[model samples]
Target: MRSFHVSKPRVITVDKNPAYPVAIQQLKQKKKIPEGIQIRQVKYLNNIVEQDHRFIKKRVRSMLGFKSFDTATSILSGVEAMHMIKKEQIDLRD
Candidate 1:
């Protein structure tokens, strides 16, 4: 939340996690978040964030199984690097 640049957000979308609203209330009391900022706990609203992971999930689902944690980490790192390159967020030549 600190990474976001909004001075005063009208609404904040969050999942149905119990701690989320409590955290928001704490922030509101501390003047971190606007007093009237709406905390939306809609379950389906989180699909927006999950949508980006679909591609990675699809690829992972096709794999038989990772040999170990290290293997999974290495493969995921490569997948992410490829994604970054395809999105032009990172230069592959670098």
Candidate 2:
């Protein structure tokens, strides 16, 4: 979150229910966050990320396990980089 140059970010978190107050309080003290930047809380919107993780985990499980740390890293890095690149392409197309 801090890596992105987004202020007043609308955070969409997921759990059985929304518990955004704790997260908002924690963010309040962070020096990097600017004042007056509203932090909006959203719940049950993280299913997409969770679903994506499920596919990646399935791929890992299919391998029985990673043979080496580097191989695992390479696979995941490629997956993430490709996902980002493709997402940007889609956004541009829109």
* Best model per lDDT: 1
Residue range with the least summed lDDT across 10 consecutive positions in model 1: 46-55
Candidate 1: clashing pairs of residues: none
What tens-digit string does per-residue lDDT give for candidate 1 at 44-71? Answer: 7755665667778977889976879999
Please list the residue runs of candidate 2 whose C-alpha ends up more than 4 Å from where it truly belongs after superposition. Answer: 1-5, 8-12, 16-46, 85-94
Clash count of each predicted structure: 0, 0
Instruction: Give the TM-score (vs. native) of candidate 2.
Output: 0.45
- How displaced is residue 86 in candidate 1, in Å? 0.5
- The deviation in Å at residue 36 for candidate 2 is 12
In model 1, the runs with Cα more than 4 Å from the true position are 1-39, 46-48
lDDT of 2 at 28: 69
TM-score of each: 0.52, 0.45
